[model samples]
Target chain A: MRHILSVTVENEPGVLSRVAGLFSGRGFNIESLNVGPTLDTGVSVMTITTEGDEQIIEQIVKQLRKLITVIKVVDLTDLKSVLREMVLLKVNANDANRAEILRTVDIFRCKVVDVSIDELTIEATGNYEKISAIVGLLTRFGIKEISRSGMVAMKRSIQN
Target chain B: MELTGAQILLECLKREGVEVLFGFPGGAVIDIYNELPNTSLKHVLVRHEQAAIHAADGFARASGKVGCCLVTSGPGATNTVTGIATAYMDSIPVVILTGQVPTPLIGNDAFQEVDIVGITRPCTKHNYLVKDVRELAHVIRQAFYLARSGRPGPVLVDLPKDVMQVKTKFVWPDDVKMRSYNPNCKPHSGQIKKVAQLIRDAERPIIYAGGGVITSKAHESLTWLAKNLHIPVTATLMGLGCFPGDDKLWLGMLGMHGTYAANMAINNADLVLAVGARFDDRVTGKVSTFAPMAKLVHIDIDPTSIQKNVSVHVPLVSDCRLALEALKEELAPSLAEYDFEAGHMPWVTKVGVWGKEHPLNYQASETTIKPQSVVEKIHEITKGEAVICTEVGQHQMWTAQFYRFNEPNCFLSSGGLGTMGYGFPAAIGAQFARPDKMVIDIAGDGSIQMNIQEMATSVCNNLGVKIVILNNGYLGMVRQWQELFYKKNYCSTCMDAQPDFVKLAEAYGAAGFRITDPGDLDRVLRQALDTPGTVIVDVRVEREENVYPMVPAGASLTDMLLV
Candidate 1:
């Protein structure tokens, strides 16, 4: 199963490498990762998505906590959580299927950020499943380009 | 002040307070070497890139700090794979910096280009291929952090030549934030109590200590638990020195070359309390048969390590130190009135008789001393206080059989990987980690040459590490195998006669000695012990002696074939 870990760590030198190091060192695979400053100074929030068993995830968290620079770790996947991702995809939608693509975008509450006679670029944000479904629907429309901002997540409640 | 990526690499190293580096330079790494002249860090040029990394590993093991090694691209980086793997297996903390081909040539396979990040992935704790100069400082800093933080192991950074050449403004990050790399040292109290209860109920209990005891500084706890409970103790190769060799409860090493009594104890014990040690195949010897009679109680800092290799009955995944502390609490109350006299005497006597008969016996020629005798003499001189490091092969086995290590982390060697050229650098690391203690490298002839270039590291650093080479004329262990299994076909087991180790040491400005006479063993060892600087003792030992009590590979520990 995939595990999403949201970690708050001391904003210091070598933290990201340490995280990546832990994964690669132990031979764990990281599917995606995103990091940014959190609400507090000298603290950054990192959301890491990886696939492993309960033991491996526990080991990863335990090892991460051993670093003096790491402050806390939260397995967002294990908690009730809110997640978001921003993706800007440029697709070939100009003269061929512009009307069909616009209609599809409207149905999914997505926006047409850029447009040309032959192309209509789409911007959409939702949960991972929703995003994948949107991308899956667009695949039949002769998609030209795609990109994703892995995942950024937080718990649903203040208690976590 | 703003700095270039190269400067930032040096600056971050400075911030980490790294004083010295061991490595060789080449075209790709020339830029970093060029930047070195302006920094306060000292770099030692070694003969081989592998030796350089091993030297850094030695420093790390000795000092409890991350050791640093630098190498250029392709072959230079490839040469370090063995040393990196050695560190990974032994859990030594080291940061390896390898130069890479220019970014444009990375995929083109230009001259001296290698996919180092890919090659070293499994061997390293983590690795990076830096394409952007802006991330150089963060990468280097993170390498150090990851290398030294928890269950410490080697980390690699492959810097593309282009990134090194590119000029960029550098700002040292105030902090590094990563969600996936937290390390915890604390043990759970409840789990510890359950383990203590198991230990209390265990009638035939044994403590299996590994290198973690030394790494966690839990020697006192191990000693206390063994003595208070009257439990016999056995060690994995990494666990040597966790308890005094002179202690009656000490059953020496437990595994392929382990004693029969130790193996029996592990096999028959009701509870096997394994602390700080991983159940490596070399130690388990046919995992299914290992400790067949025992219910395993495993305690380790890394939770994933528990039950990964061998099944555990009671698993308390925590640091050895914390687990020991918590165990002390639970054991203090439930402990029954124990009488060591009746239960331990017969076993002690049997081992004593075995020791006297075996006596680590070997033949010493009039012109050549025996390596076993040299080890015995060293043990005699130091009273086993010295921290001994060894390379792999027959000599490592001989050391395990003869040397009586009484403290934890006092004996360092390559057990799982069994890598050669591990001795000198690991000893250097061990010495650096514990400067007040005497550190010696007991290496075989074949093993020494594998990383002999580190003479420069010792010479430059002025570390008083004693290097004792058991100079048998052939690759002793492999030669033994040939004689036993291949009808003495010999093959390429013979060395290039012998290297002039005395002249070699002198060339590096270190003192050297060659002991060909067994009579002079005691006298020469005394002088080496008194010498202030590093001394290389090239003892000419018998060329054909084999380490006995061998269980071969893939055999049960109970089955042994002696020469």
Candidate 2:
């Protein structure tokens, strides 16, 4: 199972590398990782997605909590949350295939972000499964290239 | 006042109230070595890098403060890796600093250059690579904060050579910027009551204490809780000193080589209250069969440790000190009715009978001083005030068996890592941490030589450590195993020519004593203890002596074959 760990750490030089070093050195395979500054000036939030057995995940979280720079670590797999992923796919498209691609795009609710003589770039945002399915349907027209921002998640606000 | 990075390091150390540092000097760390002459801080120069770190670990374990070690990069830093990992596993506070090949040559893979920060990240609580000269003071301060705070583990700082040379204005931070390192020490009152109620109703209650009790300084509270609740106390290897061995209520250690009665008691107990102990596999064999009749109550400062090993019925996430105190208070009012009963008296009597039957008897000869005799004599002379450190193998087990540790932190051994050559350096570290107390390393010939280089450190720093070496001509422990399982195929366990440790000590500018006769055991120990600096007692013992009452690894705890 994939477990998402949300960690807050002090923003300082080499902090990111230290965190990455910990995972790699300990032989923990990180599936996906995203880190950026939060509202706080000196604190940064890192959302790391790791696939491991329950015990391994628990060990990883426990060890991560021991890091001095880390402020808080929350395993969000058990919480009610919203998870999102973004994927940009450029597919072969001309008048011949454009109508079929547009129909497929409309079904997946994807917006065409760019267009060229031989290709069209469709931007889609949703859960990973949804993006993968849309990309699978558009592959018939020949996928020119693809870029994906891995899963990012947070606990949905109670009011929402 | 102008300050160098070395001086800034000293001031940072002073703020953390560190009085001693164990290390060795090399070309890269010469700046710190030069600055050492001008400071009040005492630096112990171990012969090997590994011993320095072990000694630092011993200091931390003995003093409940962050222990510090300094070394140069590359081999010096690499050597301490095992020691650092050992401290990390046992949760002892240690801060290690390695001088690097100047910043310019770091990435060039210059001579004596090693990525100490990257190497030690997993084994350390945290680590810093000092790139900017201005960050030295802050990094040093941070090292201490990370080491001694929260769960308490080793932290390392790799200082580039150029950074040490660059002159920097220094100011120690009153508090570091670790927003996430807060360790929860406060006991939840609700959980305390639940534990107390469970203890109150337990027909057969046992309290299993581990090293955390010693680390948290919760001996008094633990004893109070055990006594107030009329609970039997069993210690893990690390927990040996938490409860007085001579105390009637103490059930001795629990696990593989643990007493039969202690294991039986834990096996039959209705409730097992574990304080600061992780149920290591060595302690709990055949997990499905272990303590089958008991419901576990685990109280640890680290929340993850509570249910990591054994399934716990009640988990209290708090420091041992606070939880124990709270448990004592809650159980104090109604505890009298549950005081020691006739059933446990049989166990006490049975052990007493076993002692009388076995008598810890070892034959004394005219030509050699028996290791057992030396241990007994030390115990008689020290009156249990001295702390004993032991290296791994036969001597470690023998020390654990023979020496009665009546106080917590009185026994320091590499129980988790089982590292050889750990004794002398650890004793040096323990002695420096507690200058007023007597510290001795009960080491075997094979184990002592692994880190015997530490004699230099003891002598140079005037650590006042006493090393009582049980010098058998062979690796006695391995020989015993070979004798038992390998048809006496000794292979290479035998030593051809042993260095005269007496001369070795003298070479290091320290005192030396020789114990050829068993009659001189007491006198030799007393003399060594009275000496101002380090002393090595090379005791010739029977080469075939073995530590017994060991249940072979695959066998049940009850399947011990006594030799």
Candidate 3:
């Protein structure tokens, strides 16, 4: 089963290494990780995705909480949540394939962030599946370069 | 008033009630050593950096306080790694202070520079490298806090030389507030109720305890519960002395090299109440078949320990003492409902049969001494009142099997890391912690020489520690393995050219004794114990002795090689 953990940690040196070291040292496989400064200046939030059974996931969360620099850890696996991943792909787009690429991008609700004489840089932000689909389509045209920001997720607010 | 980082470090240590520190001076810590005499903290200068940490570890285990050590940078910092790992493995609370090259030269590959913090990150519970002088006191406080806090383990504070020399105002914090590292000390009330119900309903229940019981000082609660429930208690190597070895309910130590009765009992048990013990591979043997009949109830403070190697039916994460106390309270209401005596008698009878059928026994020859006889004599002389430390291998097993420990913290050994040369320095530390109690290090010929230089530290300080070396002319445990598994092809297990241990002891200004006959073992041990200072007794035992009831690697606990 796949699980997402939202971890908040103090913005300090070696905090990330401590968090990463716990997972690696214990042989827990980390699927994806996205980390950045949070709204508070002295704190950072990390969204980690991993695959494990209930027992393994529970152990991972508990181990994460054991780090002194870590402030809080929440398993968003069971909660109603929204997840997103962003990918910037540069595809070879000559006259023959430019229209077809734009049509596919429209279908995925993505934007052409940059364009050159023989290349088009497409930017897509959505759930992993959608981003992956766009990348798959762009692969038909030669993908010159690619970069992805790993999954970032949060609990869906119950405003409705 | 302003103070240098070195001054602040001393002030903070004194505030924490630290009277003694074990360390070796080096270039990186010159400033701290310069300021050492200004403070009242007495430092025991160790010959090797590794012994410094081991001594501190032994002190911590004996005193139930965080042990502290200081070492210089580069090789000095690296030497403490094994000791730190040993402490981490056993969950001993130790604070290691390592000197680092100046902050400006940290990554410049300057002389005597190593990233101590980076090196110890995985082994330590927490570690710090103070780049600023203002953070010195706070980091020191945090180091102690983390070292002694929940599920205690070693923590390192790497102090760069420049930071030590910088001046800053020292402000000691009244409290340490770590929001994330709060360990759940109290077990949930509902979980306690469930566990109590299981205990009431269990017909073939066994209490499998470990070092956590000693760490939490939960012997009274554990004893109360075991006595009330009429349950048999089995312990791991580290868990020895947590329960009275003389008690009728005791099944002796369990796992690899454990007694036949303990392994058989755990294998046959239907309900295993595992307290403060992880299911280590050595204890479990073949994990798939270990306690296959039992529905386990694991109570541990560290969440990661539960369901780590084996899945538990009920996992209660809390301090062992707290959990046991809560379970006792919960068991009170239902105590009258269950007829424990009638229900548990049959199981107890079966376990007793197993114990009687395969008791731990060894024949003592009239001409040549056996290692077990030496330990048995030591036990008789000390009456299980002395603090006993052991190095790894066959001697350690003999000590664990033969020594009857009735109190917590009485048995200190490298149970987790199984580090050799751990016993002597550890005994020195234990003596320091318990000045009135007799402390002894039961060592092997192969193990004692690893840190034999510590005899100087012991003699200089008048620690009065006794070292009993079982001189078997071989790395006995590895030799046993070679004899059993490798067709008697002993490779590097032979130590034919060892030193004259008695003379070596005398050279360090300590008394020494040698015994070759079984009859002389008791008298020599008594004489050594009566001596005013440290004494080393070299007992030449049977060269081919082996620890029996052996569970072959990857074999089921039930399949034991009993000779």
Candidate 4:
């Protein structure tokens, strides 16, 4: 089972290493991790995606909460949450393939951020499935370069 | 008052009520050392950086206060790594202050510069690197707070040379408010009620305790619960003194080298109430089959320790003392309704039978002294009241087996890390903590030499720490392993050209003695104990003696190799 954990930690030096060390040292595999400053000063929020069984995931969450810098950990997978990832893809698009590429991009609601004489750079932001679908379509036109920001997530507001 | 960073560091320590500091000075901490004479804090200069940490750890364990040490950067900082890791493993609270290169030279590969914070991240509870003088007081305050709070462990504060030189107003915070690091010290009442109900219905209940019990001062509660319910108690190496060793309900130390009765009781238990014990691998050999018939109720302060190794049915994340107190409260109302004698008598009888069947025994020789007998004599001479510390290997096991510890903070050893050279310096620190008590370090020949230089520290401080070296001339534990599992292929385990430990002690301005015959062992030990200052007594023992009732790795606790 895949699990998304939202962790809030003190924005202190070497905290990232401590978090990463806990996962790697314990032999827990991390699929993706995104970290940035939270709204509160001196606090950072990290979203980590990992797959494990019930026991393993329980251990992971408990271990994360054990770190002195980490404030709170929420298993967002069980709750209603929104997750998003952004990817930038530069595809080779000569005259012969430019129209087809633009059509495919339009169908997927992606934007062509930059255009050169021989290539078109497109930006897409969505869930993992949506980003992967756009990347798969762009591969047909020969992707010259690609960069992906790991998934960032949050719990949805309670619905009364 | 305006003060340099070094002066501010001393001021914070004094305000924190630190009376003694164990440390070794070098280049990075020259400024601090220069300012040390002005403060009232007594500093015991150690020979090696590692011993400084270990001594401080011993002081903390014995006194229930955060141990403090200071060392210079680079190799000096790195030397304390093993000691810090040892303290971290046993959750001993210690604050390590290390001097680093100037702030500008931190990452430039300057002379004697190392990233102490980066190196100790995995081992420490928390660590900091102070780049500015203004933050020094705050960081020091936070370091002490984190080191002694909740699940206590070592915290390192790396001070750059320039930071120590900068002048600023020394302002110590009255309190540290770490929002994220609050440890849950109170057990939920509902969970306690559930566990109490389980205990009421349990046919064969066993209380498994660990180091947390000692750290949290829960021995009275643990003993009350066990006696009230008539449950047998088994303890880990770190928990040896947490329960009275002479109690009839005591199943001597449990785990790999645990007593036969303790192992069998754990094996046949129907309900295991694990308190403050993280099911360490040594404790739960073959975890799948461990307590196969038992429903485990684990109570620990560290949440991660609950399911990190072995899963339990009921997990209570709280301080050991608090949890035990709550459990006792929950059990009080239901106590009158339950028939304790009828429920647990049979189980207790069975455990008692196992205890008598294979008691820890060793034959004493007329020519050579047996190490077990030496430890037994020490226990007898001290009336089981001495503060006993040990280095790793067979001597440690013998001391743990033979020494009957009836009080908390009486037996100190490197339990989790099993680091050698831990005992001598630890004995010094323990003596400082309890000046009226007799302190002895039971060491093996191979282990005593690791930090033997600390004999000077003891003599200089006029500390009466006795070191009894069980001279087996081999790394006895490994040799036992090779003899049992590897067909007696003793590979490089011999210490043929070892130094004369007695003379070595005399050279350090301490008394020294050597006892070769069994008859002279007691007399020499008594003499050494009566000596005014530090004394080392080397007793040549039977070379082939091995720790018995051993369980091979991956074997169930029930399976034992008794000799």
Best by DockQ: 4
lDDT of 2 by residue, B109-216 (tens): 889888888778778878888888787887888788777765688989998777877787777677787557678888899999999888767777788898888888
Predicted structure 2: lDDT: 0.81
Clashes of 3: 0
Cα deviation at A72, candidate 4, in Å, is: 2.1
DockQ result, candidate 2: 0.46
For each candidate, what is the lDDT? 0.81, 0.81, 0.91, 0.92
Residue B498 lDDT, candidate 3, scale 0-100: 90
Q: What fraction of the genuine interface contacts, i.e. the true contacts, does candidate 3 reproduce?
A: 0.75
Q: Which stretches in model 4 have alpha-carbon errors above 4 Å?
A: A158-160, B333-335
lDDT of 4 by residue, B323-405 (tens): 99998888877679887867899999999999999888887678888899999999999999999999999999999889989
Candidate 4 clashing pairs?
none
TM-score of each: 0.75, 0.88, 0.97, 0.97
Candidate 1 residue-pair clash tally:
30
Q: Candidate 3 residues A1-160, lDDT tens each?
A: 9898999999999988888888999999898999999888999999999999888898899888888898999998888889999999999999998999999989999999999999999999998789878888789799999999989988999824
RMSD of 4: 1.6
Interface RMSD over true interface Cα atoms for each candidate: 6.2, 2.2, 1.3, 1.0
Model 2 stretches astray by more than 4 angstroms: A13-29, A39-41, A52-56, A88-106, A111-123, A135-147, B165-169, B336-373, B460-464, B478-492, B506-533, B554-563
The collision pairs in model 3 are none
Task: Put down candidate 3 lDDT per residue, B1-563, tens digits, no spaces.
Answer: 99998999999999988878999999999999999999899899888999999999999999999999999999999999999999999999999999999999989999988888888999998899999999888888888988887799999999999898989788998988776677788898888888988898889999999999999999999999898889999999989988889999999898888899999999999999999999999999999999999989999999889988899999999999999999888886666887787899999999999999998878768888989988988999998899999999999998988897889999999988999989888888888899999999999999999999999999888779999999999999999999999999999999988999889989999998999988888877799889989899999999998898899988999999885
Q: What 10-residue stretch in candidate 2 chain B is worst by lDDT? A: B351-360
Model 4 chain B weakest 10-residue run by lDDT = B333-342
